[model samples]
Target chain A: MTGSEVKKLFYMENKKGVLGKLKDGLLKTRRNLTERIEGVFGGRIDAQALEDMEEILITSDLGVKASKEIIGIIERTDPVNLRETLKGEIFNILKKGEASLLTNGHKPAVIMVVGVNGNGKTTTIGKLAKRFKDEGKEVLLVAGDTFRAAAIEQLSVWGERVGVKVVKHKSGADPGAVVFDAIQSEKAKGADVVIVDTAGRLHTKAPLMEELKKIKRVMDKELPGAPHEVLLVIDASTGQNAIEQARIFHEAIGVTGIVLTKLDGTAKGGIIIAIIRELEIPVKMIGIGEKIDDLRDFNAEEFTEALFE
Target chain B: MFEGLTNKLEGIFRKLRGRGILKEEDVLSALKEIRLALLEADVNFKVVKDFVERIKGRAIGQEILQSLTPGQQVIKVVHEELTSLMGESYKKTHLSPNPPTVLMLVGLQGSGKTTTAGKLANLFKKEGRQPLLVAADTQRPAAIEQLSLLSSQIGVNFYGTKDGDNPIRVCEDATHKAKREGFEPVIIDTAGRLHIDDALMDELKMVREKILPHEILLVADAMTGQDAVNIAQRFDEALNLTGIILTKMDGDARGGAAISMMAVTGKPIKLIGVGEKLDLLEPFHPNRMASRILGMGDVLSIIEKAEASIEKEEALRLEKKLGTDSFTLEDFRGQLKQMKKMGPLSQILDLIPGLGKFRSEINIDDRELIKVEAIIDSMTKKERGNYAIINGNRRKRIALGSGTMVTDVNRVLKQFIQVKKMMKAFSRRPMGGKGGLNIAREVMKWQ
Candidate 1:
């Protein structure tokens, strides 16, 4: 779909505001990339133009492997139509990862948020909680990050800010127990959605991965197909190692979607395009800033527009 | 993190091995691989271009040496370029001559400023100085609480105002408190902010103006991508940072941010966070990291840590065996016994391939080491020297003798093979200390 078509069809929440926010949000990345390829796609067939175009995309954090693939695909097309061909290739891949979270599934549908340390997991949860609460759903945030100091407190502050009740325990309590307890009581509490805030861990830590698996197992036992969404929150600034994070975490815990956090900054979460192209994990959301209102659903057209802007 | 880059470089060099001289085509293809590897490592595009250009200049037709393989010659040039680009000298946080040295930590959001504050305090506290951790991060929710909790964990003094709405006021209050409490070094943990955020940048400038920090450290994530250089430059322009503390170095990020930041800002990384624990902070060694990026393990860091637990002679012997590729299962067993004294085998074993992929938890620490040791002990002398001879039947027998599962024996054998190859990778020559460049350079003189 074209950028305007998607903007018109989708974005019922903030048709005007979303685009404005995204424009400003991606200003740095836009300036960096848009300026690099300003004269690239306009010329007749020139190998220099294509090489520079590939470099622009790679420099914007699209990754070497993905950039090479896209460049190769674009090379087959006539140079005069490079922009349309490139956009088409990106839109095709972006479309694969554009689904939103399963918001209307089972009542009190569970959303498990996970990532390596300091990738804005708690902040993303706060924003998600605000969104769900704004939608008039009874949101219950479970503090499953018992590892980091004040992690529970961080989630609690988000809950307080968003006007939702949080299920939590003291730091160092068993996270699986917390998840089990949250799941068991959600129906009685009349909660319409449960967002799990898990401890940030590198996927390379096998035991931590096992713990996450245990948490999933406990959830499934308590409610089959619980944790309907396992969202991996990747910092936009994260480099090539994000591939490993996506691979291992998906292998260990079966990640259903990815939330690209801190996209408001200059670090193009362009890696998500790479992740989706390689791993097929849907891009459910993009966290624009630290504020509760800074999050937006992953719109393929909007994301590609921002990247190619 | 660097395994991919090293493997590619090694493969490219291996293709050119046994050649007495570097052909023009060989160097061009090798330069292409090096360019891709650097880009994949997330080094800044501009920096990568300059780097590849330099390598091309140094590795072209006239640069070949008769005494070395084409691979060795290219590697020597590449290693020198990496080390020079990263700044060859090591550095630490600049402590003032006067007491109450102030260090202001600043960076982008979630760049680990608060955690690095704790680590810096902990490191200095271990040195017998009472370092105060100041939680001036008033923006993020519960950031102050996190720093306060870290201070308590580190058993060092902490200074934070619960209702200090302004971070400048908070730093002002914290510096006074540090002076009053005899906290020798005041670590002001400023809130992480986007470099483009003018208001927050101004706030940091105000905090610096008020506290007059002896050192302004930009705590950055080693996993940061191309924006790492831009982020560092902006912060350096705003705050004129004294150094950097790179966190999450333990993770499998190629840590290209380290190279990018140092190259752009010309700032030395003072410390690195290698693990989650506060005590996992260690001095930054540029040469070791440079060597590491080139696929040479951080042999000096490992040898130095080992020296603390084992006798100097034993440490030297272990180093010799590794350099000579004579490290056997028996030597592995002996090292395990001594490594037990150095703390968790997994942490020290990050330099070891395969076994380090997943540094097991504490519960799996010494127990796994003991099982592997027993499996090795159950092996015959010849089997110890040659791990390949341990067949399925032998693995079952070793498992029975060690009173463990056969899978345990299999894992030990796998680890032995990996460790064997890992040692061979480090065996080009003695890796630690100076004169490391001379072997290739020294050989070049014979040309």
Candidate 2:
């Protein structure tokens, strides 16, 4: 089957399952951000209630700018049906920013993943590899994060678990060279997709970012117009730093998509809206749990309802 | 990004200073700015609400201070309130008088529990106490090896099974070994689940029961924002945690967890993991952290840095000089050279109170310090003892010798006279003797 056909089949089989996972994943956030808003709405709709709702959104890790925008939408809409107003506003923001993972409908789609340390970049890569592989596409894992102590080993472990081939060099090897070799192998094996994992360096580190630029350049040099998707993985629990990270990474290497992780663990998952609204980057996927299948495609309506429900 | 809170507060304070007298509307506007800062920092909304309310109650009906702007007065209140909210002072991890004080670490996965375990062991070893590391996190792949690697790096004793041993069994065996080996603290690193699952809590509960640890520290990632609060609450309910080790503090975390954890969980944050290195562990001081977050500069930390860098007799002599009218330009230049020994002049300036807001604007170039040193070097002993002796030709000669203009010498002499007067005035006050003097008192208390 073609990739689109496979995706359609998967969606058909697991639409309800995906929503159920999202609901379960967002339980903590709902309690933290929405339940308080619900309590405020249950009372008389006054200016105090409006300010309380605004406070809830801001405390939920939504950026000051996005939260104010949301509050503005709520104020313009009906206050009696606060839940509906919030849902509509959040849905609009998320839907406007929604984007699907681009495959390019070509052989060997190149997806480069980057993020700060401990944001689950390698795990996301593993999950994506398994996902495409399950859809009957050839997947190749590139262990481009050679600077971290156990990063290569971690990627290799995930590769082994997923039963896909991992292209890696020894620890401390040149990451650009690793990506170059991985792309060579992808073409040699005729892989349908190659997911490259870069080192999780802080965005403030200039020399390391220079290294990332070099890797991107190498990928394009080896295969013209490669690195088809520069996916930035952000931890959902991140506060304002999420926006800053998205801006810097996007500016430095051109982040094409976002993979938000650790949604199940934090109420700060409101950062999703902040990132989407502020950066205008599509959140292609959201990881709710540590399991490989815990990831689900970003759905604006589903996410908005999940928050309120 | 992480500095956003400090920057915002500074802007608010600047706006507040722009207005002359203390007004209720000004305080309200300032409180609103503070509310946004706290919320943006990921502080719990309710906590921020209560914090702002408390500050508002104090700020709104208070007499204005003649010594400070209304903005500075509000900032002082906030600094004190934040300090108390975070817990007043540094809390040392309670060590049992008996040997083999057990410390079990528990938290959700990726919060740096394993690395923090290694750091804690390294900290204990540095204190000349024997610490045995127990790798009880058998569930995660390579976790045991990770701990063992850290143990080897820190040269601490390690206890783990090559084969898959249950966490409870491993912890029990490690406790036994610690007792037999007379290790002062047995630090057990436990497994972490992605979420709070029954199986994971059961496993942690079993380990806690088997070891009966003296301290259960939740190694939370400071970058996790509000999640850290929930994680600490859950772990505290389940394990009755003694303290917290907030890891990844050096990251661009808004530090809401650091601000809220103690208030929410009622557990003092004992240590913080500032970096990935084993030696990067630091004692958590609420006052210092609060001051740092407020951009008021952590004067206590700077004083500690000074105490570490300068000899006791030298500091005492400087203090005596300040108390007497004997603080001359020679001693001023000597003090500048001594301060330079601690670190870069810019960094040193960051630790001074009231300087953080203008830290970026004021450029205290290290080269400028050298010029000041050169100018002071060119002065005669009599002229150095009393700046009044420096006539116009003497100033011109000193400026020429230092490769600077006569105006440079005049500026230095003027600033020296001002600093001497300020020190003379500060030395006599007992209470509320300026922000800098209070910091000096805190350092003396620490000593």
Candidate 3:
């Protein structure tokens, strides 16, 4: 068949897989928050009922501020359309902050991924490399997280799996030098996109935060206006600390967007609303599973719909 | 990023203290703040609700109403209740009387099970117990290598099957080897899936049945809020865990999971992994954790009691605190409070009238001491010394500042004069007689 027909066929198969993973990853969140709200609707909408709904939402890792805001909307609106009112309000928060990766137009668009340890910085890089490669781009993986012992090897494993080239140094080498080398390699090979993975360092660690700044400076020196997107990967299960982490990292390095990972592992995926409302940073992707295909470009409507379904 | 939960709770109580009496409304308002603080710290909502309710029940009762320091009494109740909620006492992992105690570490992916397994092996090795690291987590990419690397770093014996061996078979074979090799603690690090699936659970169940580990320790990431509690509960339902090992204590987690995990799962947290280092493992203590959460500063009283019972090196540290000029107003406040807790002074004085020679060593009643503290608290650093410089105007300002009358300030000044005279006399006591030597030795007991 022709190119457009092949693209349509792939989209047909990929869309089904994407929705399936979304539903699976958000199943616990739906059961814990949305389903509980559905049960509340079967009764009178009173102060007690509204408090119960508020508890469910807040306990789902949605901060007290956002949960109360939604509860206020539910209480003020007509009771007959409570679910729509709540969903619409949540959709508004996420819809306004919607963003996608800026990998187009720029040559070898550099994206820097940063977050605290175990928030899946390395794994998400692996998935991003795979996705960009699947889109027929020349992708080069840069192992910029030189602090962690297995981080280099971890990204290299993904590089091998996705059939992409991973530029790395020794475990304790300066991460800026590694990024410099990767950018040099990308220039020589005329790569389409370069995704860099930084070590999983806490925002509280000043030296590590300084290291991230140095790496960004090195990227700019090599290719001015490089690192087009600085993505912060946050674990879905993290509570209010996720906001603090995002705020500090954004202040330190000006994070462009977020990648919420380990969605399937938590019932508190409601932290998504908290992050969006508090940070105003767009969530570019959601990690639904451990597999490469589990990471999907975020759709605000699909995410809100999956919560109810 | 991480401060004492007690500081926030105490901020609420500081407001209540201004009210003079503990009313039900005051208790309710303070409980509301406590609930939010606990929730923000990632404590389970159910646990936070129950914890606040319990504190409110005790706080609004006659105990707080009748107590002289009602606000402090409420805080004490919170500290006590928090300690009980997190498991009343410290619990050590039970070692089997028989040799080769097998421990199977299981959790979701990225929960630090493999790293904790290495830490546990290193700890047992430091205790002079032989430990074998069993690499049964053959699923995740490089999981086996990660565990083996940790083993080599700590120089512990490791057991692993060749490529493509089922985890259950690997665990079984590893245990067999551990027993034959005389390893006292066999740590079986099992595989973890990104999410809990029946396939993964069934495989873990198979490993559990085959190995029949003496202790099934759940290694959970402490930063996971309510999910850690749910994971602990689910794992407990499946594996019947012996204890929990909370990893990433070094991180700036609100510590909600560490507080709620034991309550939700009804399992003790045997150990905590503070950092990536193998030697950063610490035994979990509920009382000290409660004190730290309340901003009570690690509850040094627990260490003091431990020193009293064990007579360890920590007693020397306490002695230094007492013997040095580092004893400031803050230390005096603590000492005054501790002296009131020591009981009636008349009986002690009747037993030993010679206590007057060693006045600093004596535990005197502090009911009159609180007023002295208020007066001293109002004094500027310069005025705390050179009492002669405190003229009439300064005395009036000091009285107004401390909310005491000028007459009360004068009475405190007069008491300080008498105490100074007595201190001069006691300082001149000769160190030759048996009584003097006995007094010096009695002072050393507390020092």
Candidate 4:
């Protein structure tokens, strides 16, 4: 699509109720103020123009801290080129804290997917396995979610489609034992990466969480530093609640990075900005569609621009 | 918002509320309520099973039973477990140190991708960042136009050619433009298909390769319920998503999507769209959200909104008056005005913990509020401060002047008297200490 066409897509009117209305209002106000400021300045920066810009920023839902920092930079910078300078300052703040995707230099980087039930943990692992397999890496799937009968079968189905080997036990088996076996099998087969899928349980369930922790411990013991990446999968559709989910998972088991799934669904994608603003955790990847290749590495600047667009 | 769950919980808790200790059966009954609520909310069945088991384990423990207030202790346990079930800490998005950090927007058709892109850009623009918008969704009719319009609306720079082109190419070019133009953040809006189609996957892969975005955000609609979780799984498998944004939370959705989606998909929900407006977006907070879902009003959030809307000194002054039972109709009008400032009455009502169940029953229509305001407007300044002066004749006159019926005015007066009496009794109650006055003070300060 042409850049203009892409921009048009980004600007589509959100029909959903209050959220849509709020977004439209903020954008409209910002646009009007920006135009007014630009008209007044005529490409020249002035103190009044700076103040107007600050109001615009504050109105755009940028938190007070970030807005103040931006304003501070604009106040301190050369007035003649204030707008660009302010933009540059805000960009710097957004770019400050970012985490990279999992890359352990091992023959097969072991990424053990962790998350509660219905957070798309199993499917994400399946997709990750497929992505690695498509990249010509020897990938193995281990169904550690022994609690659910369908979960193991689900991973097995994905494993077959992705042309990867899946290791699983019967229903009601030990998840830790399953991971241990999968790792041993992968090592024996000289696999490039081993992706383990564990049972989905609430982070609140201490015993279940303990079980997951135990599984991680066993995986590490079997293959030292084996579960190199504990990618916490979260559903993007949960809106602000996703932040809470991230917190619980991180506390129960250290989450190295996050895999945000289902971005293609809601206008609340702006929550990512809030997450970054509040938690400062780096998002490793995002899922936009239900395809093996939909998982892509996260880019904050691109995300910010797409959101505004 | 959480009225359904809260009502179920309250019914179960009512039996245990007055009791000093909660027996195993009492905990079991509450768990049953939780179980039903979870199921109704479309939480994954397996997750619910494990959750109930965990809660049961803690509830049956000797420590809880031996507590001074076992019922409250059990409730606290449930609340804490629920909060933990979500997540304990806020996870921030990972921003790259490099300039032109790419963020890709992805979602299924009708998922509000374009709108979310605009909201995100506006968010960054508020941060004073020069964000470049990339229209990468080429297949959908008017997709690029939609994005362009949003970018202009948000006053952000748009990057994309007019000619029909591949989305990946547009992203590549947009990245180049962002770099050349010195834009620090670049947002790419990608195409989405009805289901997980191969063509769409290939296009997303191409775009990912071209842009190598710093963050890949998946936008999902909360109204889709369990399907949202499945869709998220598919997307995560394909794109290795970095974060998630749930849209359309302002609707009548039971918020099952929020719970089930999170349980099924491990991606952190970065933001929530409470309304369609650019400013309606808010950062996800688990504790507040848990309380919201439990049918417990988020007092802190309510206070924050109130603080934002009203002067702190005025709020404090009003609080003091409420404490002494000196709150008058003038204060009532002020409170009404404050409620108006917060949002629509119905919307505010939804935020009340247990009141959600009666939302439909209690028609807090704006028209009714307007009628009340009109009646209050007709009152003399003296009568407003001292409602005792509002005699029957004056009530009829005020009703006529306000364009409301005498019955409506009488109803308002009666309700007012009840409120006054309740406030007086509340102030005199010895327990009206810190906790007792909290709800009453909040209600009085609503304006």
True contacts kept of each: 0.67, 0.33, 0.38, 0.05
Best by TM-score: 1
Candidate 1, superposed: residue stretches over 4 Å from native: A1-16, A186-189, B65-68, B309-347, B352-367, B370-447
Least lDDT summed over 10 consecutive residues: which range in candidate 2 chain A?
A1-10
Model 3 CAPRI rating: incorrect
Clashing pairs in 1: none
User: Given candidate 1, what's the lDDT at residue B85?
Assistant: 86
Backbone clash count, each prediction separately: 0, 0, 3, 128
- In Å, residue A151's CA in model 2 sits off its true spot by 2.7
Tell me the tens digit of each residue's lDDT in model 2 across B1-447. Answer: 235577778888888777667778878888998998887787876788889999988888665434357777888888899989998888888788887899998877677888888888888897898899998876554677778877988999999884246678787888888888798799988877644676678767777787789999888777766555667787888889899888776555667777778888878999987666577677888887787778766767666666655656665566677756788998787676666556545445545766555544554445666777889999999999988889999999999888999998998887777667766776786422122333233222221
* Candidate number that wins on TM-score, 1 or 2: 1
Clashing pairs in 2: none
In Å, candidate 2's interface RMSD is 8.4
CAPRI docking class of candidate 1: acceptable
- Top candidate, metric lDDT: 1
- How do the residues B43-92 of candidate 4 rate in per-residue lDDT, one tens digit apiece? 54456667899889998999788988887777777777777776654567
- For B186-226, candidate 3 gives per-residue lDDT tens digits of 99998765435766787777788887899998888777866
| Candidate 3: residue A3 Cα off by (Å) | 35
Q: What is the interface RMSD of each candidate, in Å?
A: 9.1, 8.4, 8.9, 16.3
* Candidate 2 chain B, poorest ten consecutive residues by summed lDDT: B438-447
Give the distance in Å from residue B253's predicted Cα in candidate 4 to where it truly belongs.
2.3
Ranking by lDDT: 1, 2, 3, 4
